[model samples]
Each structure stands twice: as structure tokens, then as C-alpha cells.
Target: MGKRILVVDDEKLIVKGIRFSLEQEGMEVDCAYDGEEALMYAKENEYDLILLDVMLPKHDGFEVCQTIREYSDVPIIMLTAKGDDMDKILGLEYGADDYITKPFNILEVKARMKAIMRRMNKREQTKEEKTLVKGDMTIDRDSRRVFIAEKEMNLTAKEFDLLELLAANPNKVYSRENLLNLVWGYEYPGDARTVDVHIRRLREKIEKNPSEPKYVHTKWGVGYYFRG
Candidate 1:
């Protein structure tokens, strides 16, 4: 079966052009012209990737991306006409995997999509490993599930990725930048604070004492590591 993709844009010509290009590559493409319609289609269907435009009539891409992150971790690539760095930062802040400026080459779009999908496929394969145990914690990568002391723990997509990385390589220190790149993808334009937020949240969910973490430990001025 061909890969499925959703292309969201207000410009009919742009959407048509993208759809045609992807279709030539044997991809099944879906189109949404506005933010509300995009959200509706997203909720009702399962898509491998979402190409979303930043400017729209109803809700705008940022709002759509934020709302969707509340429910799904499907890869999203934000499309923008503005050349502002902050817009790119905000897209990553809202859980987007990547962003592209407007007037982009169609070939580049196809290339970027292929690269992101490859990373996602590699990640899914990594998740096929057998369960990992750390003290009272159990991480089942196949199902993307985590349990502490026999009780299942709820975690967002980013939170799970952060924990999985640290736990998989116990005692190995990872700087904020490292975590940001490995977990959120290299195209993400976030800072150290982003990693801090996810780490703090993960500790709260897994540690019996968030103030003094047992499994995840801060390495003074270096970074963070997981106790094996």
C-alpha cells in the first residue's frame, strides 16, 4: 500500500500542485483548504504525515497543530510564507516536526517528506525492542508504554521519547541540545528550556520524588543521565 499524506493549504493551486507531485510518487494524498476542515479530516482519518499551512481562514496552523498535539503525535510539517525565525520556533514549540518557507521547490517538498518519513520509520523499528526494566520501572517500546512499580503511567509523545532515550542509554549524559535534536528531530528550532520542560514533566510522572529524582539525575553543569 502507498503511504498516506494530508496536504492542508488555503491556496487551491498550491494544494493541487502538491497533490499531483506526491501522487506521481505513488502516494495517496488528501487535501484540506482551511484549518477547521484540516482538523476535521485529521481527527477522522489516520495520516502518515501532515503538510499544514501557517495562514488560514478559520483557525490557523499553529492553533491546529497545538490542538492536534493534544491527541496525536503524527508528524507535521508547517508551511509558511513569512521569513521570521520566531514563526519557525513557534511551529516547533507546538509539536511540529519541521517547517518550510513558502515559494519552496516541489522537489524539495518531496525530499523533505521522504527524509522525515524515513526517520519516523527508523523510530518505529527501534520501538520494536523487548521491554526494558530499570528498578521498578518497565518500558515496553513496542507499545510505547511505560509502567512504574506495576502501575501504568500516562505520557505525551515527547515525554515518552525523552524518557526512552535516557533510559535506553543509562549513565550517559545528554545535554539539552542533544535531547532536543534526538527526540524532537534536528529541524526543531527550540532551546534548552524545551528539553527542561519535557524532562520536568517526565520526572513528575515517573519519580516518586520529583524534587530528587532517582532514575533521572541532573549532572551539575553537564547535563542529565539515567541511573542504570
Candidate 2:
């Protein structure tokens, strides 16, 4: 069966365009013209992915995204107008899988959609192979689940990638640049602080003591290492 996608946007034309593009790739598409309707549909149905617009009537995409995250982990890719970095960051911080600026190429949207879908699908495949236990922490690669004792941990895509990378190689010191390339799958621009933020977040979720992290350790002047 084709993968299912829910496209939520206030713009009818944009919805049609996205639906057309996605359906061409053999995906099943559903559309919602407002945030309230989108949230309703999302709550009642299961989708492999959700394409959500930032601006909407009634509830707004950010609120919808935030609400959905409370109950589901379905991947969400937010759509926003250009120069809306704050919106993008807010979406990401609230658990969005990705964001695309308006006036975006249909091809770029399709590419990102496919990439996000690939990552989500990959996590399913690896869910079974992941079995790295460190003290109270358990990293299950198959379901892409991380657990501290019996409590499940919620991690962003990048955070999960970082943990998987370090846990898979135990005691290996990977520099920020290396981690950026490995975990993010690209050469990150600007300072390597992106890695730092993710690590900090990860520590908060999985560490018994964030100030004195056990699984992930900083090698001052170097980068980070996982103590197996």
C-alpha cells in the first residue's frame, strides 16, 4: 500500500499542488484547509507523514503540532513563508521533523518529503537491530526507542541519530564536525553548536544527572564520546 500523508494548509492552491506532487510519487494524500480540521483529522487517522502549514485559521499549525506531539510521534514537516526562521525553529523545537519555506520548488518539497519518509521508514527497519544497554539506559534500534530504566525518552530525529552513532561505537571520541557529518548527514554551516544543543537535550532526556552525564561525555577541546 502507498504511504499515507495528511496535508494541512489554509491555501487551497498549495494543498492541491502538494497533493498532486505527492500522489505522483504513489502516496495516498488527505487534505485539511484549516488547523482545527487538520487536528481533528490527525487525531482520528494515522498517517505516515503530515505536511502542515504554519499559518491557519482557528488553531494554527504550531498549536496543532504541539497538540499532536502530546499523543503521537507521526513525522511532521511544517510549511512556512520565507524568512520565518523563528517559525521553523519553533516547529522544530516542538517536535516537527522538518520545515520548508514558501515559494519553495515543488521538487524541493518532494525531495524533502521523500527524505523524511526514508528516515522514518529506516527507523522501523533498524528498530529490531538496536540493543545497546548501558546501565539504566536502553537503546533499541528497531523501534528507535530510548529508555532510561522503565521510562521512555522522547528524542528528535537528530538527537536519536547522535545517540545511535555514539552508542553503536562506544568509547569512540567523535569531534563535532564528524558528528555533524555523521548524524546530520551533511557538513553543517556555522559553528558546531548544533551538535552541542542536541547533546545537551539528549543528556537531559536520558541522563540520571545532566550535569554529570554518564553515557555521553565531553572531551574538552575535542568533542564527545560515549562510554559504551
Candidate 3:
């Protein structure tokens, strides 16, 4: 089945270009011009991915992303202004799977989208139907869901991937750069801080106290590991 994607932006020209490029790839594309309309589309359809602009009328991309996250873990990539580091970080904090700066090449955008979908597909194809139990947390590999103390936790796509990797490995430490390559894809053009933000968010969700995390641990100068 061809991937279904929703492209949200205030700029009609940008949306037109992206929709054209993605449609040429044989994927189904839906376009929305503002955050409210984007949210409406998201609630009604199941999309493989979403390309959301940071600046939009009504709620804006960050708000839209956060609202969708309340019910879905669909992969979302934010489009931010060039050199806007805050926008990128904010996007991740709000549950975005990734981000691309403005003035981006359509080729690069396609590559990023494909990479995320590829990883998701590989995971679904290869993982066995089993659960990983560590302390109070439970990871359902087959369904890509995590639960703590029997209550289901809301984890984003990247968060689930990162947690599954670490929980499966026990105490194996992974450097920020190594994790970025492994979890986000080797071709991903992101800094180590991206890993940091995801880690913090994961810790907040699963840990009893995020300030002193029990499941995900920092290795001081090295990186992070899951203490099974």
C-alpha cells in the first residue's frame, strides 16, 4: 500500500510543491493550509506520516502536534524556518518525529520521510510478538506500546524505538551520536542534543522521577543506558 501523508502549511506554494513531489513517488498526499484544518484531517484519517509547518494560522504546528499525540503516535516531521534552533527543539518536545529547516531541497525532504518509514517497516517486519518486562515497565514489541505499572504510556514513534533498543540491551551504554545514528538513521542531519531531548521526554514518561531516572541512566561523560 502506498503511504498516506498529510502536508500542513500556511504557504500554498510550498504545500503544492511538496504534494507534487510526494505524489510522484506514488504516495497519497493530503494538504491542509492551517493547524485547525490539519488537526481535523488527522482525527479523521490514518496517515503514515505528517509534514507540519511550525508557523500556521490558529493553533500552530506545535499545538497541533501535541494535540494529535494525545491519541496517536503517527510520525510527524516539522518544517521550521532556516536557522531556527528553538523551533526544531520545540517540535521534538511536542512529539515530532523529526524536523526540516525551510528552504530545504525536495529531494532531502523525500529522503528523510523515506528513512523514517523504512525504519518503522523494518521494525514491524522483524520484531517478534513478545513483551519486555523491566521493573514496573512493560514493552509490547508487537504493538509498539509501553506500559508502566499496568497503565499504558503515551510514547511517540521515536520514543518507542529508543526505549525498545535500550530495554532490549539492558545496561549497554550508547553514546549520543551513536544513538542518533541508530535511532534517527545514519543519514539524519541532527545534533546530539536531539537525542538528549528525546531521552528526557522518555524519562519523564517512564521514570518515577525524571530527575533521577531509574530505567534510563546517563553515563556522565559517555551517553545513556537502560538499567534492566
Which 10 consecutive residues of model 1 have the lowest summed lDDT? 185-194
Off by over 4 Å in 2: 126-130, 141-145, 149-161, 174-188, 191-195
Residue-by-residue lDDT tens digits, candidate 3, 81-163:
85767667677767787889889999999999998889778866877648999988899986788998899998887788899
Q: For all candidates, what are the clash counts? A: 0, 7, 0
How well is each residue in 189-210 modelled by candidate 2, as lDDT tens digits? 5547667878999999888799
Higher-ranked by lDDT: 2 or 3: 3
Residue range 122-174, candidate 1, lDDT tens digits: 98786645788998999988777899888999887778778889999999999
- How far residue 63's Cα lies from its native spot in candidate 3, in Å, is 1.1
TM per candidate:
0.87, 0.80, 0.87
TM-score: which is higher, 2 or 3? 3
Which portions of model 3 show Cα errors greater than 4 Å? 154-158, 186-190, 209-212
Model 3, residue pairs in steric clash: none
- Ten contiguous residues minimizing lDDT sum, candidate 3: 182-191
